[model samples]
Target: MKFTRTANANWKGTGMDGAGTISTQSTTLNKAQLSFKTRFADGVGTNPEELIAAAHSGCFTMQLSFLLSEQGFTPEDLNTEAQVTFEDGTITKIHLKLEASVPGISEQDFQDTATKAKEVCPVSKLLKAAEITLSAVLL
Candidate 1:
């Protein structure tokens, strides 16, 4: 299966002074200059890193949820944060931290399941970073 989104940007001038608008028609961002400053710190709007984080988090969460269900355990909640590190204009590493409120599961089982999810998740496989690490907490 394939997924896609569209973004349009209009830039005026150069460097940080330039601005653009972004729209996804999905309620989050709609035709606004990327230089909004709050989210991107004077970023030109919808930078690659932010988009990568969104994709990684969404993919990891879905994969984890599916694994949990397959293991006969339902997850109360799963919180994931993904950090994409860039060095010299290249993505170096992706750090994924997942905190889950899962019941009736041992720590080892949870770790094993999470490992499987990380390995099988499409995003993880797609990422070409040198390192991808996952730290999962069961509560």
Candidate 2:
């Protein structure tokens, strides 16, 4: 399946002082505000790193759910959080923390499956330049 998704950003003024709005094709983030302060400081609105984290977490969780279904294990819940560590103008690491509830799955099997999902998820593959790590808990 090959497809394309797009998001647009409009900025005005200098990098540090400029403000921008981002709009996605899906309109999920229609005219969402973003700015240098939002990205580098605690200012309100969204930023690229936060968006990347959201994408990674969503992708990984969905992939893990598919893998679990394939392995004959139905999950009660799968909560994943992706932390993108951006330092010195680069994304140094992405850490995935997963809390899952699956019936009758071994710890080792769960860990292995999560590892596989993390390695194969589309966002993970695209962000391979960053060090990716996972801490999965089977609750």
Candidate 3:
């Protein structure tokens, strides 16, 4: 099986004074903003780090759900947050926080499954260069 996704950016001007709009094939993120302020400063725009965080969080959650199913439990809800740390113009680390509710599963089992998900999720593998930390709580 093969899957491909595409996004394009059109930037104008230069450096900190420049800004760009990004659009994806599906238009789910149509004309998202990217700029120096969005990247380095706290600005109301989308940046690469934010996109990576979102992708990681979504991927990890789905992986955990599959893991939970394989462990004979069904997850009721799973909430995840990925904190991508950028410093010195480099991605330093990604901290993942996951809170899950799985019926009929022990806390230890849920935690073990979540840890496994961290190791095997596609996005996690892709971002292996960065330090990946997981905090899982079973509710």
| Clash pairs detected, candidate 2 | none
Candidates in order, TM-scores: namely: 0.81, 0.98, 0.96
Instruction: Please give the TM-score that candidate 3 achieves against the real structure.
Output: 0.96
Clashes of each: 2, 0, 0
lDDT of 3: 0.92
Candidate 3, residues 18-64, lDDT tens digits: the string is 99988899999899988999998888789999999999999999998
- Give the distance in Å from residue 8's predicted Cα in candidate 1 to where it truly belongs: 3.6
Q: Please, what are the lDDT tens digits per residue for candidate 2 over residues 16-128?
A: 99999999999999999999989999888899999999999999999999999999999999999999999999999999999999999999999999999999999999999
Candidate 1: residue 127 Cα off by (Å): 1.3
lDDT of 1 by residue, 37-107 (tens): 62446545566677788889899899999999998999999999998887876788898999999999999
lDDT of 2 at 94: 99
Score each candidate by Cα lDDT. Answer: 0.81, 0.97, 0.92
Scored against the true structure, residue 111 in model 1 reaches a CA lDDT of 97
* Ten-residue stretch with the least lDDT total in model 1: 36-45
